[model samples]
Target: MADFTTVVSDAHFLEAPRWHEGRIWFSDFYGLGVSSANEDGSDLRVEAEVPGQPSGLGWLPDGRLLVVSMTDRRVLRREPDGTLVTHGDLSKHAAGPINDMSVDARGRAYVGNFGFDLMGGAPIEPTSLHRVDPDGTVTEVADGLWFPNGSAITPDGVLLVGETFGNRISAFDLTDDGRLTNHRVWASFGPLPTDRSVEVVLPALAVAPDGACLDAEGGFWIADATGSRLLRVVEGGTITDEIETGTPVYACALGGADGRTLYACAAPDFHAEPRKAATEARLLATRVAVPAA
Candidate 1:
């Protein structure tokens, strides 16, 4: 167990946390918007709103903010004038709602999708991860990913994607053209799930990777959606440490003035109807030794 304090408790459901510009920015999945707050979770403010519900978040080289509109499968960019415009339309290439994204320094966004009807309890489907250029050009970077959820990019340009249902993190090398290649299993908790059904795959998972954040130690802190914990993982899938948050942790970020604060988005459940109906979601924080990049 780790010491944690509640920073914000008024959200419906939060995901995709990013530490930037001296604040913790996150997407309220059911709240249909993006928000930011101070280090201790004070001074909460609505940064932007998306009708389709926002998920991932990133900033371009020009300081423009990019937000993922999940249901609509699009990336919305916030201009300098506070306008929300379509940066990329991923619906054509994505099989389902886009969930999370990792943006490169050059403004290329690699995005993942649910790959199936989650709320509808449809069977889980393998999907492709799309690379969206700053000019709104979309292309399939990799295919046959199992429920790709959260992602992070290393300073060395390796792309690490968390497969929520696959219980593993997949790695890819980024090309100059913003394409992903040379796929390898960066980390595998156990084995490839024999069951193909979402119901079975979900239950069989030991650690359902949700959102992720890179630390200064060149490792990742991952939110375990079903495990009620956060794991600090190094290369080769070694679980270095674990932070046990009593509730289900959907996302995490390492940020603060010193970059040691670990922020988690937690809730009693992630069900669509229940989480949206009640404001049980919260932003929780704890201090860690590893700082954010």
Candidate 2:
């Protein structure tokens, strides 16, 4: 059995967890906010309210926080005075609601979208990843992703994006100006479903990679939404280790005082109405042997 402990509870579908400075920062998917807390979930504080619902969270080198406002297809920045302002408008570049994002050390953010009305039971469709500059210019840098959900940047500046519906993790080389190129399969867990309907694709995923974080061991710690586990994968599509969370884990982050703490965002289901009506989602944590990146 995998070690698991609840850091907090009664959340409205938590996702997009990040370990920043000395706290765990995360987005409450249906709660419409972003929050942070100490290592053990103490001193929990709401840092920003994203009316459209928050998905991913990242920080610029200058310490400003960048958060994804999912439904609106926009990125918001939290100013030092706590004001939330538009960082970029991605509606023009995205066909559906934007999901996970990875902001580089230079503050450039790479975001993904659903490419279809996921909650409305629309047919599953392919999507692209967009890069939002620090100054709020938007550009479609990579296309043909299958519901890109989570992402992380390697020490050498490579990007690993988890494609939930594709049953694979895609990798890219980050250009000096914040664009992605040289796309390749970083990992694959199963075959892509033949049926594109949401009914079939929803249950067909075997690995359903969602959110991810990097470790000092040069591996990825991924949340498997359908597999109910946190997977650690190395280069060449190899799963090095895994921790069964016993619940649907939608996102994860590796951070703690010593950088060995693995944080997971879990809930009973991903449906917005059910999660929004009841606060059953939680933030969970476990200790790992590898140091974080």
Candidate 3:
């Protein structure tokens, strides 16, 4: 286990961490906003407020902030003047609440959804991944995903997505127009789960990948929601390193002045009711060998 330090304490379930513009930016589900802080957790600033609950955080090519409003299934864009406006609406396409997202340099956002009423104890179901263009057009680029969650785009144009219930990291090639092609599994922890019930599937999963980020050495640092740890996995499902979080780590990002800091969003559990009523969630950090990609 690495020596972990608290970056931000008393958060209401932090998720979707990103290193951008010399700061660590993230979303707080029950906090109803997005925030950024300095590398050592100083100079904390609330960037945007989304009453629907913010999950994902990204930036457009023009530097406008893009946020995922989970409950309403909409993407909100923060203009230069700091006002939020609907950038894209996924209400019609998404079956459940939309969650994490990854934005490419071209401002194309690849967003994912829960696919089922996770908090309501509904059975897990496959869902689609939507691509939001620069003009805010929502298109279902891929489907049959078991709880698509965190995502990242490599420098070589490969889109890697973590399927929380699928026990695998799926890859896709992005076309010039931002469309996904050549879908394949980048890493598989185990065979595709056969059970749909959360009770049955979660205990059987080899790795429950939740939030992830890419590193310069082609490694993927993933927060294993079920394992209460963060794993450094390479191609073909090989876990090269692991960090025992001692708490449920839902998301992670690699960032710092030198890009060697590994930041994790952690809490006791991911239950909505409990998380919304308390402030036990925290952003923890540790030093790592590799830098961000």
Candidate 4:
């Protein structure tokens, strides 16, 4: 019965939370590393640090970590013995900084990027998405996307991606062998950006299906980075409920032994001029329905 009003603060700009090996692993974009903690946010530890800002995070099927190094446009891995190795360099394909990613059960990772230097005082453009193989080869999967961000793979092997700037989610059917096939609209956040100004559409996202160990129903939990809310989406993609907060919520994940606890990364605009981290930018948590697998 812990309501959303109970805020768990100061998670250091966390993103891409995943429940693995009895711990909640995630990234701190500005902090430039990955860390984890118990479901209760206890025993927080820095699992690994990338030289550039680390955004997306996931584990290989064998349990090695795959991280997105934003500034360097590379995918890095942490070996079993805690050694960091370059898994792949994507500088040639990524238009700007690589952002979030989702690794399939088969170990293939779908990586997204900024597409354009939105913070570089230039005209905005849509970003692109890529499929990165285990051996470090990069292939352009999709293009003409506005700030492609959070992504996830369904238990049935569908690929779900969130377009932060577009305020919608898309799903791509995965082949039996793990290749992306059919592409279609999954859901749209038409009612989001309640403010809907030119500047309010920039929120980071992390999506999970319902009946999940963390969200035991069919819906997506979205961190409304600029909206200051964590909203839940039903199977057909409807906002069933919403948790309001003072901080602009960024990305989210479900963790904890039972997978009912939700962790959110909150942060101010890292691309903002004067570049001040919002004091309200911190991690928050709450107990919720079990997550979908």
Candidate 5:
């Protein structure tokens, strides 16, 4: 447990860490790229350069990679030779910038967005969720959502999405033909506040951050972007535990040999301009008991 260390730091913006092919693969948001590294933070490698800002990341059944190109509202596939090609164009389907995503065993990816101009300093809009099929078809899964950030699919293929602006997690049914149905609320906040408030006023926690993953025990690991903590939630939407970090926790995933190590990609100044920020962005790793199944 004590061996955990910082893998990468001073990064511009980082997201989406996944354990694939014996390594940790993720996307660099403000860095405008994708990369991989060993569990021990060695053998670091840059896998691709996505020009439009890559967000959520997933793997196809055939060893290819899928990334959400946030700026342009598109999904891309990384070929074996590290070339990125379009998997689907979501310009008309997405109401806002797509954030994090999760791919099921069948290669269907569920994506969500900001729902409005968040950084523009305007009011928040209703963000929605979309489901992308393997055939490159995009469909609206749910609408009128608060800001959908990180998302995950259960081993049974049930979809769970983090509603950042709503401060709750939503569960959906994934049909056999790749349709999302039976939308329901899975979890929400209670009476306690961790550490996300600012200026003596608690910021409304509607799941405003990004990146999420499922644990082997059927629980979900969520990054409290403003809270500076990682929360473990069960299927019934109970908070099992919460672990604190130095910076605002933006994204998270399970890596390492036993899949028991949780890697959190955090940044001290996430929305701050590069030169004006105090702490540089970083990737932090910690150990956990349960593995991801």
Candidate 6:
């Protein structure tokens, strides 16, 4: 087991962690904002406040910040002067609140969303993934995903998306025009569950793939949302390493001065009511062998 330390506490459910510009940037869902902190838990700052709730964080090539506004299904871009403006509207494509996102080198963002009322206890349904161009055009790139959540784009253009309820991570080949093709299973924990109820699916899941970050060796460090651990997974469903988080981890990111530090977003549970009612979530950090890709 690796020793974990709290980097940021009293957060209202943190998610979508990313290592950028020597800081750990993440989203606080119930806090309704995006924040960043120094790796050693110093210099905490609130970068942006999203009334609709922010879940994902990424940057454009030119250094502007892009955030996923969950409730309104919009991607808001933070101007250089610190103003937030709607970059893209995904309301027509996303079936539920938009979740995590991955911005490619060309500034194309692949966004995911919940397929149903997850916190309201509705049956789980497959959702679609959309691509938002830098010019703010929204297009559905793929559909039929089981609760599409966190995503990461490889240096070579392969996009990996975590299917939290499907027990698998799906991959797609990114075309020059920002469309996703060659859809296949990147990693599978078990057969897809036949039932859709969260209660039935939770206990049957071997690994609930959530937020993930790629390593230099092509390994993916995934937050096993249902298992309360961080798994270093290579292609073909093999787990090369694992870290016990003690709390349910929703996201993980690789970063530090040397890129060996792994950060995790954790909380007691993902229930909206409880998370919104109190601040029990934390950003935990631990050293890892592999660095960020």
TM-score of every prediction relative to native? 0.98, 0.98, 0.99, 0.85, 0.91, 0.99
Per-residue CA lDDT of model 4 for 134-191, tens digit only, reads 8988888888666677777766767777777666777788776556777776777553
Number of the top-ranking candidate, with lDDT as the measure: 3
Model 3, span 151-255: residue lDDT tens: 999999999999999999999999998889999999999877787899999988899999999999999999999999999999888999999988889999999
What is the model-wide C-alpha lDDT for candidate 1? 0.90
Candidate with more favorable, higher TM-score: 2 or 4: 2
> What C-alpha lDDT values do all the predictions have?
0.90, 0.90, 0.94, 0.70, 0.79, 0.93
* 233 Cα displacement, candidate 2 (Å): 0.9
Steric clash pairs (candidate 2): none
User: Can you write out model 1's per-residue Cα lDDT over 168-235, one digit (the tens) per residue?
Assistant: 99999998878788999998986777776876777789888899989988888899988999999987
Q: Per-residue lDDT of 141-216 in model 5, one digit per residue for the tens?
A: 7886767888888878788887776667788888988888898878876322343323222265544435688888
Local accuracy of candidate 6 as per-residue lDDT tens digits, 1-293: 68999999998999999999999999999999999989887999999999999988899999999999999999999998999999999988899999999999889999999989888889989989999999999999999899898788888889999899999999999999988999999999998879989999988999999999999999999999999999998889899998988889999999989999999999999989999999999999999988999
Minimal lDDT window, size 10, model 4:
205-214
Better of 3 and 6 by lDDT: 3
Q: By summed lDDT, which 10 consecutive residues of candidate 5 come out lowest?
A: 192-201
Q: Decide which is better by lDDT, 1 or 4.
A: 1
Model 3: lDDT of residue 113: 98
Q: Which stretches of candidate 2 lie over 4 Å from their true place?
A: none
How well does candidate 4 score on lDDT at residue 172?
A: 86
